[model samples]
Every structure is written in structure tokens, then in C-alpha cells.
Target: MTTIRTVTGHDSAGASTIISHGPLPGCEEFIHSPGFSAALVWRTPPQARIVDHPGDPAQAESVIPAPGGSSALLVTFPPDDLAGGADFDPLAAAEELCQRLPGLGERFEAEAPGFHRTDTIDYGVVLDGEITLELDDGRTSMLRQGDIVVQMGTRHAWRNRGNTPARLLFVLIGAQRPPRGD
Candidate 1:
């Protein structure tokens, strides 16, 4: 479980206040298999904007917000040895996620050629254990504790080659692509 401390400012006094501080009510847990589990920490609305007064700024949902919104999530991937024979369905999972999160289905690939791409910039940090980021071009990068990765809308996948669960924190921000001709 992860704890999130949210701070806000008061409109009248302009003083910082700890609005809510604690673990999330519950995480959107996705059980890819018996051992692999992923959780969505929190999500913001498409039109989210900071306000002067304290109020609800982040709408609760486990999906990509509009093209300018963002979301944060925590994922724990089981070791490849354990997950090797696990029954996993990436397409089904992606379909379910797209149904819950608008615009996500468009980026999902049932047969993504071992990689999936989304039109969003992502910031991923290794929180515990280790994992590998594999690209469609056959290149891979190992990420360990405290390491960070900035993924720009590219085809990729996260793989846990180690013998332990790999935990990661990822923040995805929606972005716009330049016009086709530009």
C-alpha cells in the first residue's frame, strides 16, 4: 500500500493546508496473473486545474484523462520465472482498461509485436527491486531502485527478469502530436 499526502492552499489566507494525508482509500488493483499485480494510485480529470481555494482538483478514476490530463500508478511485476507460465492476456487487459479509461483503447494493441505505445509522456521511477524496459527495436534498459526513466510516447514494455517482484511508480501525462505534415 502507498500513502499520499496532499497539500492545498486556502483561498482567504493563502496558507498551505494539509487537506488529506493517508493511504488511498483503495487502489485499482489489476491482477494480470496469480503473482503479477498492478495498482493505480490516483487519476486527475481532463480539465483539472489548480485553484486558489481548497477543493477537489483530482477526479478519481483509473484511466487517462483528456489529452492534457495525467495519472499516477504503482505496479508490481512478478519475476519472470514465476510469471513465465502464468495465464496473462495483454489484449483483454488493455480492452478492459480502455473501457474504463477513455482514449486508452486507441493506443492498445492486441498483438503489439511485444510492445505497446501510447501518445503520452511517462515518468517512471523504480521504487523497489529491479525491472527492464524493452523497446520494439530489441533494445533493453535495466532499471533499479532510485532509477528514473522518461518515456516519450514510444513502443515499450516493462519486464521483470530478476527473481523478485519489481515495483515501479509511473506518472503519465497526456500530450498532443504535431500535425502529420509538420
Candidate 2:
């Protein structure tokens, strides 16, 4: 599916104007993980300043926003059964994920698969279809279209157990993890 992203910014005259309108740059379906797609929509570094031409922040190096930063992403997941088929290539898939997602991709646990954690608070909204949110304790929450989830720097993973694909939008804000008590 083509995701048309429209960006707004202030013109030289200080009037709000549409900066760009089209499919997100670099957004593509994963060849190794057929049916899966992810797009980095936007990003803002710490203490972001408003500029007349901000350009496209989606091309930034890291997907994991730094402290006080934020990022927006759109992800589509195919059914669980669709992954790791006979033609599936794990190494290629991992390489592609790391290259596309940058820091965020490295956070995924190899031992536990989808399980991962980050120092950021995320607000996720189910855009279409159904999915299951699994936490570290193995507890899961079934979510459907329009459902929302506030993830607080927790270890979690998303599972699409349904027959169809599921789409989700997430906004993540960088956060500081408090010092652990000994």
C-alpha cells in the first residue's frame, strides 16, 4: 500500500504551506520478509527548532530518537504464518531491517525473537486489522482497529496472529530510564 505523507511548513512569507505531498521516501516492502513494510515518517532531535525548510527528517540515521527527541513510524505486519517460509532468508532479512531501522532494529532480541526494549515512551494506534501485544511476562492484549496503546519503555513485541495483515502507527518520545537501585 502506498502511504501518502503530507508535510507542512512555513513559507518565506511566514504563511503555512504544504512542503511535500507524496509517498514516504525510502518506504518499501521487505523482500526477505514478504508482506512486511515499515516507514519512518518523521523525526525531531532534542530541542528541535522550527525552520522555514526543515527538509525530510525521515532520512535521519537513527530511528530511535535521542533523549528529548521523537519519531513517528508506520508499520504493517503480515500474518505470523507468512514469515520464515521456505524462501525466507533470515540473514538478509536481519541485514535489511538493521539498515532500514538503524538503532531500533538492533534492539530486537535474537534469543527471544520479537522481544525488544528501548528507552522511549511510545503511543501506538491500531490503524487496521488485528494484532496482539505481548509483554515480557507472556501476557498478551488483543487489539483491533482504532485501539490505542501507551507503551512505557517496556519490553514487548507485536504479533499478528490473524489471517490478514495489520497496520499500526506509532509515535515514540525519547525518555531517560531512572538509575536502578542495587
Candidate 3:
């Protein structure tokens, strides 16, 4: 299984009371693993969360945080072929992603080889190089730096045309919502 690592992000997160919300239902609070670990928790409502880190200024990214309710968390999954991947279907996962992340932008088709996602809202910012976006009408768009894209139900794909590897901050949200207060 191929392993995907995360780079150390912003530093100095003081002890503050930030609401812990997730894209999925029954998720409310969050806690730090230890030593203010970078582990982001998905807690049920009412109960708050505690954070702990290993004293290391750098921490691996756990989950993409979002607002509460349908726009609570940004679900991210490794490429289907990645090792120990979230094993989440891209398309089907989109519905849940939409409910989790709100005020989303547009989605485009990526031309990344080994692409596999069914029913998932795939949204992300292109990091480096260029990637192609496939549309439902069989149309395609070239996504470069500073361009944001979102995908749902429609068939799409990603292709990395740059020799140097490119990275992205991607999120999977739900489009269709379940019964109220679910």
C-alpha cells in the first residue's frame, strides 16, 4: 500500500474553544491525540473536545475542518490505489461531502491515471502544474494554479501533465441531504 504523508501546517494553535463539527451525522466534538497531537476528532454534539500535541511544532494533517451541520467537515480520501486509503468511492462519497462542506465552488474532471471515484463530491485546489477536467457533456477544462473545481454525480477524471508531482487540498462533501436532524 502506498503511504501519503502531510506537511506541517500553521503553527501556534492556542488553547481555544472551537466547535468540532463533521460532514457526517452524530459528529460533534474533537480532541487532540496527545501532546496536542494533530489528530482531529469527530465528536457528537453537546460534548466539547480537548487537543494534545507531542510538543512537536509540526503535525500530520488529520481531517479538513468545516462549519457545523451539512458544512461541518471536509472529507478527504487518498486515491483509490493508495495504501490504506480511506477506500471511499469518489462519486457516492460526494453526497456526503456536500452535506459536510458548504459554499463549495465548482468541480472539474481530473485526468490522473489510476483514477477511480463513484458518487463523491470531489473539490480541490490545484497545487502545481496543470490538470484536465472532464465534464458531463464530454467537455474538458484545463485547471492551473489558483483555479478551484468541484465535481458531483458527473463523470470526471484527473491527469497530471507536469513532470514534477503536484499536490492539492481536496474535499469530499455530500450533495443530497438525508431526513432532517439526521
Candidate 2, residues 1-182: lDDT per residue as tens digits?
A: 68899988898899999998998865688888888888899999999888877788876889999989999999999999997799887778888888889998888888887889999999999999999999977999999999999998999998999999999999999999988782
- Candidate 1: where are CA atoms >4 Å away? 2-12, 25-29, 42-48, 52-62, 84-106, 179-182
lDDT of 1 by residue, 1-182 (tens): 55564655564587666665665532444444445554456666668766565444334443564578887766677786776355667666566555544444456555652267776889999989999999876789999999999998888877888988888888888888676697
Global lDDT of each candidate: 0.68, 0.90, 0.37
**What are the runs in model 2 whose C-alpha is more than 4 Å off?**
none
TM-score of each: 0.73, 0.96, 0.37
Best by lDDT: 2
Q: What is the C-alpha RMSD of each candidate to the true structure, in Å?
A: 3.5, 1.3, 12.9
lDDT of candidate 2 at residue 87, scale 0 to 100: 86
Q: Is candidate 2 or candidate 3 better by lDDT?
A: 2
The candidate maximizing TM-score is 2
TM-score of 2: 0.96
Quote the lDDT for 134 in model 2. 98
